[model samples]
Target chain A: MASIYIDNWHIVLAALAIFITGALSLLMQLGLAKSIFIAATRMIVQLALVTLVLAWVFEQDSVWVVLMLLLLMGGFATYEIRARQKLAFTGLWSLGLGGIPMVGVGIMVLTFTLTTVIGPEPWYAPRYAIPLFGMLLGNSLTAVALALDQITRGAKQRQGEVNDRLALGMSRTEAMLPIVRDAMATGLLPIINSMAAAGVVSIPGMMTGQILAGADPANAVRYQIMITFAIAGTTGITLLLATWLAVMRLTDNRHRLRLDRLRSQKYPA
Target chain B: MLIIKNLTILPINVERLELKGGVTALAAPSGAGKSRLFAAIADLVVNEGEVSLDDVNRNDIAATEWRKRVRYVSAEPSWWGNTAQDHLSDDEKTRQMAVRFGLTTELFERPIEQLSTGERQRFGLLRALVDEPRVLLLDEPTAALDQDTSLKIEAELVRLAGEGRIIFIISHSEAQIERIATRVVNIIGGKLREGKK
Candidate 1:
C-alpha cells in the first residue's frame, strides 16, 4: 500500500489543534470551552476505540465479529436517534417507529453494496463491511432523527389542523399528509444538499481520505460517487419508511390526532 | 339517537348519554371537560367507551365514515390552505351556506389568517357541514361571532336540528343556550345532569 502511516506522536501532535481551540475558547470566555474540550476528547476517544476494535476484528476476520461490531454500532445509533428527539412514542413505538426503519435500511443497503457493488470476498469481510456499514448507519440514522423530530414536532404544532381534518373525516394518512411531507423534506434535505454540493463545494471525506492514503484520484472519485449515491438512496428510503411509521404513531385508526402517543422526553441529547 | 355509553376520556366521565333530534345545549364551566366529551364522542383521542348513532355503533364502520356522520367543530378553526376556498368545495349548497353565514364568495378567496376569528369559526362549521353529518358536536360555535351573526348561525343550527339531526352544542353564553336549546344539560360535581330548557 502506498499509504502514509502516521506514528502515535503524529496523532498526539494533531490533538494540539483542539487543545489550542479549547484554550482560546476558555480564555476568550466564549462559553464553548467546556463543549469544545469535551467534544474534542470524545471524538479522539471514540476514534481511538474504533481503531483498536477494528484492527482486532479485521485480524480475526470472523463474520460474528463483524456482526458484533455492527450490533454495537446499531445500538449506539438507536440511542442517538432516541436522544436527538424532543418527543418519543409512548412505549414500543419509539423503537417500532424509529429504530426498525433505520437499522433495516442500513443493513439492506450495506448488504447490497457489499454483495453486489463492492463485492467484497465472503460478502461479510470486516475490512469492507464495517466501514461501509458505519457510513450507511451514520447517514441513515441522522436522517431518521431529523425526520422523527420534525414529524413529532409537526404533529404537535399542527394539532388543530390535523384534528380539524380528522373531524372532517380525513383518514389517518390524509390527516397527516402535510406533516409527513414536511418531515420527509426535513430528513432528506441535508443528504440531498450534500450530494448537490459534493465535488464543487468540497472534496468529500471518503475521497479526500483515500487520496491522503495514496489511492488513485480517479479510483477515489468513482468510489466517492458510489458511496454518495448509496448514502443518498439509503437516507431517502429510510426517511420514507420512518415518516410513514411516525404518521401511524402520531395518528390513529380512528382518524384522530393521538397526541397521547407522544410523551414529553425525559432524555435529551 | 346518538348514544354515549360508559365513556371515560380523562376529566370526562359519562355513564351514559342518549339524545334524540334537537339542539341539546351543553353548558359547563371552562376546563370542565366539555370539549373533551366532544372529542371522545367523535372517537378522537385515547377514549374508552362505546358511541353509537341510533343503533349503528361507531365501531361498525370505518373511522372516517363514523366521523363523517358525527362531526365536531372546535371554537377556533385551523386552516391548512392559504384561503377559505381551498378547503370549501365549490358546490351550490356550500356556497349557499357560506352566504347564509354572511361569508361572501370573495371572503372565501381571502387568506385565512386575514379573516376575522368569527369568520374562521363559521368556516370551520361550513367545512364540516359539507359532509352533512347526522350528529353535530359544536364546541362554542358562536363564541367568536357577534350577537346578530351568532343568532343567524344559531338559527341555521336549529333549522338543521329540526331536520332530525342531533346537535350538541357547548356554549358559554347562558342566553344563547336558552334562546336556541330545546333541551339543556349542565356539568355538576364532575357529572352531567339535565337541567331546565
Candidate 2:
C-alpha cells in the first residue's frame, strides 16, 4: 500500500494537535505553554531546512557533500559536548578528544551498516548513509558528553582522595581508574535503559517513523533492531575513547593529577 | 638531610632551612600558610623553590617517586574503599606498625566510615609509615588525639626519627614540640623564625 500524501493543509491541520497541547499547558498553569510553542515552531523550521538540504544533497549525488554534512554534524556534536561539561579541559584537547572519537566511531559503524547490512548501491548513498550516520553521531555525542562531564566532575570532587592515592605511590592512571569506570557506567546507562524499554514500554522514534512512512512492519522492526545495536556500539566505543582521552589530559607524565588543566572551581575548602 | 634553599612558596618564604634527619617541628599561628608550605614541599601545589634530599633535586625525580620518598599527611585524612584494610599494605610490617600505633588488627577490617577521627589520623600515619618514606611532612598529626594517644604517637615519631628518617611536623602545642622536636621554627606572616624552647 502507498503512503498517504500530506498536503500543506494537512500539515496545518496536524499542527492543531500542538496548539491543543499548548492550550492545555496554559490552562493548567504548567508554565510550559510558551516554551512548547517556541519549541514546536523551531522543530518545524529546522526540519523544513533539513528537508531542503537533504533534497539538494540527494540530487547532487556527490560523496563529498555527504562527507561534508557528516563533518558538520560531528563538529556541532563536539561543541555541544564541551558546552555541556561543567569541568572541561581547555584548547583543542577539549574539542578534539570528544569530537574526533564520536565522529570516527560514527563513521566506522555507519560504513559497516551501509556495506555489510544494507548493501545499498554506491555505499555513500545519501539517503541510507546520511540518516544512519546522523543517528549514530547524535547518540554517540550524548554518550561521550555524559561520560566526559561525569568523569571530569568526579575527578574534581574526589581530588583529595585521588591525591591521597597518588601520595601513597599509586600512579595517576591507577588512582583515576575507579572514577573512569564510574563515568563509563553512567554514560552507558541511558542507552541501556532505552534498549531495555524498546518495543515494550514504548515504540522507538526510528521504528515509529518508519512505520508511519508506510514501511512493512517486519522490515521496520528489523531495521530498528540493527539501528539500536549500532547505536549501542557507537555509544560504548565513543564513551570509552572520550573517557580515556579525558583522563590522560587530566594527568601528567610524572603520574601527577594536574587538575589545574580543568576550568572548574578548585576543590572545596 | 632536607635542604630547602631560596624556597619561595607564595605568602610563605623560607630563605634557607637545613633539616637534619630528626623531628623539626613547625610552629605557626592559624592561617600562617603552614599547610601551604608543607604542600609546596610535597610538590602538591605550584611554587618556586629548590628542595633537595641528599643533593637530589625534587624536580629531577618523578613526582610519584618523589612523593613516595617524601610523603605528606594532611590534617584531615582521606580514605578510599569500604574498609581501612583496603588502604593498608598487606604485610607483616604494616600490621606490626598498626599495632604499635595502638590500632588493633581488627581495626583494619573495620569500615573506614566507622573509624573515629583520631583513629583515622593514626591509620593515615600508619599508611604513610608503611611506605618507609625517607621524609615525612605531617600537618598536625596528633591534633585530634587524646593526651595518652598523642604521647604514644609522639613516642613512635621519636623512634622513627631516631631511625634517621627526616620528619617535619606542624604542631601548635609548645609542650608537644618541646617533648619531640630537636629544632623548633615559628612561621609568622610567611617568614620563618628560629625559636628556642
Best by DockQ: 1
Candidate 1 chain A TM is 0.93
Candidate 2, superposed: residue stretches over 4 Å from native? A264-269
Model 1 over residues A172-193: C-alpha lDDT tens digits?
9999998889899888888888
| TM-score of candidate 1 on Cα atoms, chains taken together | 0.94
Encode model 2's per-residue lDDT on A1-269: one tens digit a residue.
66788899999899898889889988999999999889988998999999999999999999899999989888888888888788878777878989998999899989899999989888899999888888898788778878888888888899888878887777888889989999999889989999999999999998898898989999999999999999999999888888888888998776767788888523220
Clashing pairs in 2: none
Candidate 2 docks at the CAPRI level of medium
Candidate 1 — what's its lDDT? 0.87
TM-score versus the correct structure, for each prediction: 0.94, 0.93
User: Among these predicted structures, which one has the highest TM-score?
Assistant: 1
